[model samples]
Target: MTPQEWVTSGDDQAGDIPSPVGFRILIKPYRLPKFSAGGIALVGESKQYADIAKVAGQVLKMGSECYRGERFSAPWCKIGDYVIFPKHAGQTIEVKRNDGQDPDQYLLVNDDEIRAVVKDPSQIKAYL
Candidate 1:
């Protein structure tokens, strides 16, 4: 959908939802968390992996809505969230493949999404 269409569609319930352009924890089924009912990263996610995943940024990119849709590379982002690139850049981008979460092609993310995760952009070998 065109950005204008997306923005105008909100005309009906604009007051009910806040504009999502900044940093905020995403709600389950992910809408930005707001009020007590809406929360960051859904209330159900366990804290168990929070630490291990922290060493590497962990941002959730929306899984493809359809098989033909182009997967967003660093599409929507949260500060510490990992960005996905279509191709790997060796040491510059540490890619650990996770098995398919769904029947679609798999979702692969760069390790850079972790909280406080930062490396010199120059250090990234080269986008491959």
Candidate 2:
């Protein structure tokens, strides 16, 4: 499903997700398309690499201490906002679903690690 669809679907495994703590933010990374524009299916290894390299995701939850210091006059992003961060910057958390589908992946990143907030996550293409 697209990032927008996934966020709005209300099917996210919220019960299984861990809340962020102390300046950390929980983000649900955007899933890469399984097929390429040329109708070629990506190999398993390629897909995995691309998944790890994905830099854009929707903000799920934030720590109590996030964006609370004098380091900024205002918050750079907020919950439900799509954001970009460094590749492989955060701790990856994978949640297995009961339906036997691929597990959902999330990133727990520092609030300072976010680079920018994206208005449209679908427009951000995977580089891999």
Candidate 3:
């Protein structure tokens, strides 16, 4: 099924995130690394540094108008794709889950903000 269809589907729905309406993208940022390359645990300031270091994320959804502009062409990224965007390019949104646990954080970014696409985010050394 297409990303849009899957999201709007009714089967066992946990809840829906804010659907990107225009040239927008919904992404779930990869969690920061818990330990450094040396295997030492990162604390307070270190953890904060790790968090801000990430510019990669998983594409959760996209707006219908994404890449469809009068001057632009087509979109390069799709749902489920790993994309690299500018640091601090998107807005943070808290999503309330149906399981009643803590809300998850998501980024709402414009399609134009995406800089590059990676097949596997895990392959990124910084993230690993």
**Residue-wise lDDT of candidate 2 within 41-79, one digit each (tens)?**
988998888776678999999999998878978998999
lDDT tens digits, residues 1-128, model 3? 23333233332434567888888899877655556658888889878766677777789889898988675766779998888888779899987767776666779999889988986554443442
**Candidate 1: minimum summed lDDT over ten consecutive residues — where?**
26-35
In the order shown, the candidates' Cα RMSDs to the true structure are 18.3, 2.5, 6.3
Q: Which stretches of candidate 1 lie over 4 Å from their true place?
A: 19-128
Cα error, candidate 1, residue 2 (Å): 1.9
**In order, what lDDT does every prediction score?**
0.27, 0.82, 0.74
lDDT of 1 by residue, 6-113 (tens): 223333432222222232221111112222334444334433232113222223232233112255454344533333232321122222224422111122333232
Q: Which candidate comes out best when scored by lDDT?
A: 2
State in Å the error of residue 125, model 1. 25
- Model 2: how far residue 32 lies from native, Å: 0.8
Q: In candidate 1, residue 3 scores what lDDT?
A: 21
Candidate 1, residue 103: the lDDT equals: 18
Off by over 4 Å in 3: 1-15, 33-40, 123-128
Report the C-alpha displacement of residue 88, candidate 2, in angstroms: 2.3
TM-scores, each model vs. reference: 0.16, 0.82, 0.73
lDDT score, residue 114, model 2?
94
